[model samples]
Each structure stands twice: as C-alpha cells, then as structure tokens.
Target: MIPVIKKRIYLGLLAATMLLFAGALGYIWLTFFQQDGGWLRYITIVAVVAVLACLIVIGLGFAGIVLSLVSEKNITFLNKPMNFTFSLLYPVVMWLGKVFKITQDKIQRSFVEVNNQLVKAKQGKLTPDRLLILLPHCLQERECPNRITTNTENCTRCGRCPVGDLLPLSERYGVHLRIATGGTLAREAVKKLRPRAIVAVACERDLTSGILDCIPLPVLGVTNDRPHGPCFNTYVDPDAVEKAILFFIQGGEGNVFHVSAN
Candidate 1:
C-alpha cells in the first residue's frame, strides 16, 4: 500500500514553493521601492504578508503533528496529513541533527516510536475482519521448500518457523494473513484484501515505509528479529504478533498467546 499521502505532500510542497516565490518577489519589490524612495510602504507591507503566509504554512504542519498526538478521535483524518508533514520535515530534521553531530539512528527510532503511538491511538476503532496480519517472506526458514506466500495453508506446521503458530492464530481469529516478498506484493495483497487496519512485521526501514504508505489505515509495526543476519532466517516473536492482532480484534484486551519456537 503506497502511501496515499504522496499526492497531498506533493501539493503541499507545490503550494509552499509558490509561497516562497511570492515572498522572494515581495522582497525584491521592497528593495527596488527603497531605492526609488516612493510607494516603499506598500512594498514593505506586501513582503511582510508573504513572509507571514509562509510561516502559516509551516505552522499548520506542526499543528497537525501536535493534534495527531492529543486528539484520538481525529486520528483517522489527521494521521495521513501528519505523516506527510513528517516526510517533508524529516530530511531537514536529519540534516540539522547531522550538523550538530547527533546520532541518526536515535532520531529515526524516536520518529518510529511517535508513529507507533499515533497508530495505537487509532487501533481502538477497528474490528477483527477489518484488520490484517502482514508477514514478510524472510520469516520462513530458508531451507523450507514450501511456498506459503500464495497459500499459507500449504505450511505443514513443521514447528521450525513461526508460521506454524501464526497459521493457527490466523484461523482462530478469522483474520486475513499473507506473506509478502517485497513492497510490491505487499501492496497488491493489501489492495486485494482491502483491510482497514494492518499489523506489519519487518525491519525498521520497511516498517517505517509501510506505515507511511498505508496512511489513514492504522498500522501497528512490529520489527522482526534477525538472529543469523538480515533477510535470511529472520524471526519475530509470535507473542508480539498475537498481541498486536488482538489489540485490534478485542479492543486491546486479550490473553497473550504463548508461542513455542521448536
């Protein structure tokens, strides 16, 4: 699910650019009027107005973020806009952090943490059928020959992979579960399934991107565990997955399923 916020962000950026251009023109007009020493007051007023307009655009973005944090009912509408604001602001924030020599990883982690809180705030509105559990193909054992991507029922419950437990959990909860290889397949699955909410498992990068892509759709991201290395033989805590699932299913109240990794 590519973020629906892309077009919105593009439009916002376009508007900001126009405002900046107007501000520059106003500044130039003000400078020329100062040299001519006539009608300089009008040019100065125009420049101040243009600068204030630019500041208002920036202020609206920050306001969106703050409202997203404080207002739970508005989460459905505000989340995507807030994500767009973050996308626009993140690079600048990172650059300033770098200039100060602050750690980028910490900054990213903080962003993810805040994103998660916003997601959780909206989860209370979801039901079981509207929620989906999205898994990564890397969660499967490398040596396994089964292709669970097309049909999870193909899994033999071999106990070697978390899919063994996940299969039953999905069936028990009556939730749609799909294993996707990459963003394209994941987007396709999301499109076909048409779920209102999603619980996604991946690395921090994938989780962050997927969350952004699936804006306005509440998504709780759980980072997978990589014991051997990245991509190959990656794992996730089944309890964590189950908890996330139940958070939407049971309105954030359910017993944690004890998962056994045999």
Candidate 2:
C-alpha cells in the first residue's frame, strides 16, 4: 500500500514534469524558433490556481490569507470555481495563524498531516482531540525519532517533538494530538482518537482530500515545511502546528501560538 501511494505520487510528478517540458518546448518551437506567435494558448489554468493557492498558503503562510475574502471572481478561476472560492478564503483563517508567527513552513506541514486524516475518514475512523499531527518519521535536527507506530512510549514527554510540548499544551485546554507516518496512517489514528475539533498538518496535494474528508468536523488545515517533495526525509514545523492547535483546538489566547479569526 505504501508503494502504491508512492507510485501514484511519482507518476503524478512525472506526468506533471513531462507536461511542463512539452509545453516549454512547444512554445519555443512556435515562437522565436518558428517566427510565429506560438501557442501561449494552453495553460495550467486549473492546476495553476491550485499552485497559486498552495503558494499563497505556503509562501505567505497564513499572512496572505488576509486577502481570502476578496471573492472568487475577483481572483480568476478556470475550473472548480467553487473550489477556488473556498481556497481563497483560506487566507482569512490561516492569516490568524500567521498573526501568531506560525511560519509558512509549519502551515504547509500541517496540511500534510490533514492528508492523513482524509484516509481515516474513508475508513470511518474518528479522532479524540482537536490537534492531530501526521508528521514525517524523521526527527528535527538532533531530535529523537518520532515513535508514532510504537505508542509514543519512548516519547518521554521531554517536550521536544512538537507532540511532547503539545501534550501539556493540549491538556492545559483540552486538545488532542496524534502522529502518523503518512496519509493512511493519519486517518486511522484520527478515527481511533476521535477529537471533537481538529488542527491538522499536511501539504496542498493532501489538503484538498483530507480537509474535505472530515465533514462536519471543523478542521483548520496548516501546511508543512517540505521544500522538497514528500518522502521519508520531509520535515515538519512543530511551532506552527502548536500555534494552530492552540487557536482552533483550545481557543486559547496570547501565546506564541495564539491566532485570532478576525
């Protein structure tokens, strides 16, 4: 199953690469090389919008979300106009995260975690607290490896891994946190935990499905810090995840992680 998901991601990337190369070549062929205007005609309109949203969400972190209420028609949409609208509104909520200094990378990483939640939804799984972490297996620089599969017993609750700090933070105001290897694992973890609210981490590719999967659950999707593609080496921003969790999960105020909805 892991291999299958990997294959899917690989194929998706390869196809995207090929399409980009072909488009570039095709444009050069028709333009300067052929002395023609060229077909600037075709574009990744829908894909572009997805990319744009991803950029705004990640690049600007939640700060760019300040513009979320501008309206879809104001932003230019080629397909899934409704999706574009919803995507645009992310700024408003995410912006709350940025106000708290949740860094863009952390926001993107959270979305990746949410991707895991989506898979849980398909299996009818539920989570217990508001904070759900679908983190990569690797540890932060000098940090111990996450033991999600092993009950986090080795966790020591040292307050190192974001979850370590999260345990106290969540407990302080009643929030929950879970870590999973990937999307499928995340969903399963969430289902078993069954939290009432959710503050999730994931990437754009995973966000759409993950956020949508937890219907009726108020979920705030935060992106991760993977400059490279997802894999065993991906890194997550614990600070950002914590901040979002503090906001949406506990409604806490005035902390390094506190973010307002206004």
Q: Backbone clashes per model, in order? A: 2, 35
TM-score of each: 0.71, 0.42
Task: In candidate 1, list every pair of residues with a backbone clash.
Answer: 1-187, 3-213
- lDDT for 98 (candidate 2): 60
The alpha-carbon lDDT assigned to residue 183 of candidate 1 equals 97
Candidate 2: which stretches are off by over 4 Å?
1-146, 157-168, 227-229, 250-262
At residue 135, what lDDT does model 2 achieve? Answer: 47
Most accurate candidate by TM-score: 1
Tell me the whole-model lDDT of each prediction, alpha carbons only. Answer: 0.70, 0.46
Instruction: Please give, for residues 28-60, the per-residue lDDT of candidate 1 as tens digits.
Output: 756665575557767666776776654555556
In model 2, how large is the Cα lDDT of residue 178?
57
